[model samples]
Target: MTQKLAGRTAVVVGGGQTPGATVGNGRAAALTYAREGADVLVVDRDLDSAEETAELIRKEGGTSLAHRADITVEADCESIAGAALDTYGRIDILHNNVGIVPAGRTEDLAAETWRRGFEINLTGMWLTCKAVLPHMRHRGSGTIVNISSMAGLLAGGETIAYNTSKAAVHSLTRSLAIEYAPHGVRVNCIAPGMMDTPMGVDANARAGGVSRDDVAAQRAAMVPMRRQGSGWDVARAALFLASDESAFITGVVLAVDGGFSLRAGIQ
Candidate 1:
């Protein structure tokens, strides 16, 4: 079968992770795109982690480049875009897979904590879009996939900052999609549901001071499917959005959650 993304160049911000026992969405997306024949640029604040992802792609006989990028900084965002262009000469997809889960109640949340969440979860995404828009505009075509969370839609209480930040991403995706549609650029968002990813397990452990296995069990129970999703589930959703398969689709918030949002009430 022919690869859906052959000849395309993709930049996945935050596409660096060793899984910590489970693969992260960013890393999964990078690998998926690479397997589908896109030259991928893996960007993350951790040079080592980013290189690890890049190396995996190369080992699979796929094209990839890795760069350390602190997305919270405007200059770093600029450099990420520059690095991708320098390495691949063109940009067909921009996957903003970076996010932070700041666990805290709104009533008692620290002001600094909320601000930090916004910086990495929201502002960083905006800066990246800004940095890459000119290039996409020049090419007159692009696809941007922002990774949000099911918490944004289902209101998984207590994590006020994270929920709000991801909710804002959904709005950003819609507004940008409309603005860029005429330019042939599609902007979309993905909301991943309860998954067995490292951060997912870690978040549960942090909240209850329990072991990852215990948290994983709890997460599985909460899902109607009676199973936790995986980074690969989210990756495939992203793949569809970033490829020509969704050519007519834009400004969509595709939820990769396992019916978590569909079940009414708090999760």
Candidate 2:
């Protein structure tokens, strides 16, 4: 390993993932960070699922620990930072990987559901940053990678709540980046296209009442690359944004969509 993150500590929120044939983005980023020599703290709402990810890292001779936290709760977000500090001493990277898709059109979407989606997809992210920003700012250095979606940039999806919340994430990333730049902190967002993770495929399948295979095929067909990207693709991108390689970059929303964004154009 090149050890891009050697001696660094990373907090990967939503490190646990939905069960599926393929890995999810959070799990992939955790493993990738570990592979690059970063001790990781895996946070998830599900203790068992989080432990599963921690165990995988341990099996690979990488250091990791699991913690459970409902990020929507401000106190729980504080606990995340506390756990990372207690385990790793200092946080060098904060990877926000939690997002939810509640499929609904604007007119049909429930007010409560819309609010809940924002709480998870956007507000929770801000809280986590709030939890860790002091430490990063005090040290005068840190990196944050937020996982957004192409839906935030383009139109055509019925997932009104998801699209709007993710769009807010883009704005949030830029806002934080500029605010913290003088303090030596960097904030960036990744807008992934159709990914072939269990969450992506399984959720669509259930929503469409179709087989997973059918859902996967249709999503792949939509992408310009003729295939859906994987968790590893996003992981590598996160790795770059988290590592020193992207030291000069911040507040940028990178599209890891295999040209899908180009085909769709901007909204």
Please state the error at residue 64 of candidate 2 in Å. 0.4
Name model 1 segments beyond 4 Å from true.
206-208, 265-267
Which residue runs of candidate 2 sit more than 4 Å off their true CA positions? none
- Best lDDT among the predictions, by candidate number: 2
Model 2, backbone clash pairs (residues 3+ apart or across chains), number: 0
List model 1 lDDT by residue over 143-214, tens digit each.
Answer: 999999877775655788898999999999999999999999999999988988877897568767888889
Each candidate structure's TM-score, on Cα atoms with residue i matched to residue i, is: 0.96, 0.98
Instruction: Give the distance in Å from residue 84's predicted Cα in candidate 1 to where it truly belongs.
Output: 0.8
- Give the root-mean-square deviation of each candidate in angstroms: 1.8, 1.0
Question: lDDT of candidate 2?
Answer: 0.95
Cand. 1 TM to true fold: 0.96
User: What local lDDT does model 1 show for residue 141?
Assistant: 96
lDDT of each: 0.90, 0.95
